[model samples]
Target: MPEGASHQSDSHTQREAEEEILAGLAASLGVVLAKPERVALSGGVFVEVDAATSDMGVVVEAYARQGRLKGAQPKKIAQDVLKLALLKREPGWERTRTIIAFASHEARNSISGWLARAAAEFGVELFVVEVSEELRARILDAQRRQVMANADLLADDLVVQTDSGR
Candidate 1:
């Protein structure tokens, strides 16, 4: 390939990688939001679903910041999304009955501790998922499957199941 072509290919590859990373992040968030479980992470954050009547459930949200970043911190993002989800009440969604997963990897211990206390005050359970190489690969694979399934559905109106039920 020519030098220009090679450069173009590299740029394309980098863009694709970034897209994939963002997609994986979104997918991880989606899975956590969908599950109904009491979970909390080191950072001040929590997720909980109503237990008594199963009709009214709310996910309390909180987060801590360590360094400079943009937009909502991890915990704040999770909380905001959960609140939106609760308000929207998307199809097949029950009452807000899950602790939103908080992103605390970037926050300092002190801030995290404060956030944790705040989450506790609100009776929210915080959840944090450690990201390792293997975990990342798994998340990517799941995202790919979802994309493929969506594509197939759009093309042929068929539901594709990637899992073997294992």
Candidate 2:
């Protein structure tokens, strides 16, 4: 009820709202980003997506860091995705498809060079989307639903824990 406490709560809410927007952008792009049907593990933390049914196998892998929407290694991840795509004999993907999307304008600009390098290396495509105000709101709503669902699951867990403790 204190003024200071309310202000802090508001700040926290705003931060959460921002995070939800970024997550939504990522999720939306993820839906559009094509993936190979059979995701297989190759040695050295590599994954292969088999697109044998299509013209070429479009392999994709994501390297994520905690609290980082996209890491400094977009070029590397792009290269790996392209390599897998090529290994699957999906050259058409290189011409028709792109990999990588960032939630922020700054992040997108910072990684543009890396993205270009990777694209050139493998002859693949690249695209980036900045989080818009409307998209952010939609993402926040979806995130709120997810958070509520999670809270419900957590409440169930707490009940089980309490019963077990007794």
Candidate 3:
């Protein structure tokens, strides 16, 4: 295999690890909350959320990409917008609040400005959170075999198009 392909695979794995840790946090949050709510996965998105209700609901986007890389900023925004779009379309998800959990404030701040603006314009509430130890542990423990199942399909499309164009 080419060195480039290996690097791509490694990056993909890193993303999966980051996403797993965040998913575990989301799961544990559901368990510790005072109010009763069901934790479930979005049909099209990989991460889980408290099931949507007429009053309120929560969806999580584990933004694993590092924020410091300026080159990645645009791609990250597009990725997040796609996730938000899915939530926006869900029936009875109007009241659903998207809690975007980042590893740190810097991570959150890197994309928060854009996300914050999106929330106001889109008429939805978007929140940024720091990953606590307990949340991190829960995410670590919750790692699964195929976290990339959904994302891989989309990624494959990009790869295929690139390969064919070349």
Q: Each model's number of backbone clashes?
A: 18, 2, 1
Best by lDDT: 3
- CA shift of 64, model 3, Å: 1.8
Model 3 TM: 0.46
Deviating ranges (above 4 Å) for candidate 2: 1-98, 104-127
Segments in model 1 whose C-alpha atoms lie over 4 Å from true places: 1-71, 74-97, 102-114, 131-166
Model 2 Cα lDDT, one tens digit per residue, 1-166: 6656432113344344434433543465453233455443344344453122243322233322112233335555555546654544432343434344334444335544655565556654333444556655554555455456667888999999999998
Off by over 4 Å in 3: 1-9, 31-56, 67-69, 112-115, 123-166
For all candidates in order, the CA lDDT equals 0.40, 0.45, 0.50
Q: What's model 2's overall lDDT?
A: 0.45
Kindly indicate the candidate among 2 and 3 with the higher TM-score.
Answer: 3
The true-versus-predicted C-alpha distance at residue 33 of model 2, in Å, is: 7.4
Clashes of 3: 1
- Candidate with maximal TM-score: 3
- lDDT score of residue 59 within candidate 3: 55
What clash pairs does model 3 have?
24-139
Q: How many backbone clashes does candidate 2 have?
A: 2
